[model samples]
Target: MTRALYSLCGADERHFFSPHCWKAVMALAHKGLDFEEVPTTYSRIVDIGGGFSKTVPVLDDNGRLISDSFDIALYLEDTYPDRPSLFGGEGGKALSRLVEGYSQMMIHPAIMRIALLDIHSILDEGDKAYFRASRESRLGKPLEDFAAGREAEREAFAAKLEPMRHMLRFQPFIGGESPLFADYIVFGALQWLRIAAGLAMLAPDDPVMAWFERCLDLHESRGRTVTAA
Candidate 1:
């Protein structure tokens, strides 16, 4: 039986980057796992999840169900120890935790607001309509109103980047030599924000930008492929 990885289709266009999905996909790519990608909408997640919380990046390995991106990464690391190390080592593990915490607690929400502001320009009319309708149906407010209220909060988030920039060295990757789970997590969260807000161009000389490029180069060299699913 083949393993299956479920993700939101058109996530990139939707101005949504499921970090969980990215973690799983990166892990699978690193491990050379032969898994099938299953695409579904956010609505479908609730309908098919049997009353569980609706979330993308759910995985089915044979008959076992695994949810959450970090859990999936850990599961894969344990299941395939011979593959490249995502946590790197003790230092990598600690850094991973720090990166994950920052991404979850600080970066994601702010980036989301920025993305919401530019959603129309990034996505086509149908996708924009679908997303707006979905949000209204789920949250009972217009996307524009929501984004407007959160603009200040999002602007504050850019300050958090200062520490990240200071922490980064002239190394090619986050962990100094190779790209780790932290790199991918940070990349996934910030990359979409950068693209949607055009903030990356503002930091052309920053180490974080160089690190980001290195991450892409490393993944490409490893034949990491991302499809629509």
Candidate 2:
């Protein structure tokens, strides 16, 4: 019953850049769970878990398969109650739901714009082709086209994080003294940008940036395992 995480990766398997996957990775580490990461490329996603999902961060714990990052976190929380809690309790779980929504709606689009071309650049040929076709179809534009003017998008992205910055000024993390799944939700998006584009979206002096540094230091610096870009 070896546990394994089917993580999304680029041409370099070490470059696991999926924001959702990073959530699962951090959740696993937060629970003190050890598992093998099965680097999965875009072309291979359909072959995983009997094609149970079309996305990565598919956790295979023993024989139980779970897809979706939030679902994985919930599964980890439930199955490993004795381990460090990812959500802490029902209150934290509800808070994490809000955090997940904020990360997806406010943060994910900004990151996608900034890292679109960079993400394409890191993929293998087949994956690159697949990525380009799928993204272009959805975006109705080429990656380069969509990623253009990203420098301007950065300011807007930073502005959107003001709520988090305000909160961080009062506490070390969104989880008050320590990080919970709430903090990891935002960390995943920033980690995605860092890994795919080597871009730092935050100002060095900002409290949000400071919080990110602390997150990178978690689980014995697990987030730093894959260096930026």
How high is the CA lDDT of each candidate model?
Answer: 0.66, 0.89
The residue-level lDDT of candidate 1 at 135 comes to: 71
User: Model 2 misses residue 25 by how many Å?
Assistant: 0.6
Clash tally, candidates in order: 0, 0
- Model 1: residues >4 Å from true position, as ranges? 11-16, 47-53, 117-141, 149-158, 194-201, 221-229
Instruction: Please report, as a residue range, the 10-residue window in candidate 1 with the lowest summed lDDT.
Output: 220-229
TM-score of each: 0.75, 0.97
How would you encode candidate 2's per-residue C-alpha lDDT over 77-152 as one tens digit per residue?
Answer: 9999999888878999998888888999988898889889988998999999998999999999988999997999
In candidate 2, which residue ranges exceed 4 Å CA deviation?
none
lDDT of 1 by residue, 1-229 (tens): 7798886545453334455676676677777778877766555676544734467788888867778878787887788789888787677776688788988778777776666756445554555677788776775777777777565766576576665677674556665667777777777776556545645423577666666666555645431243211
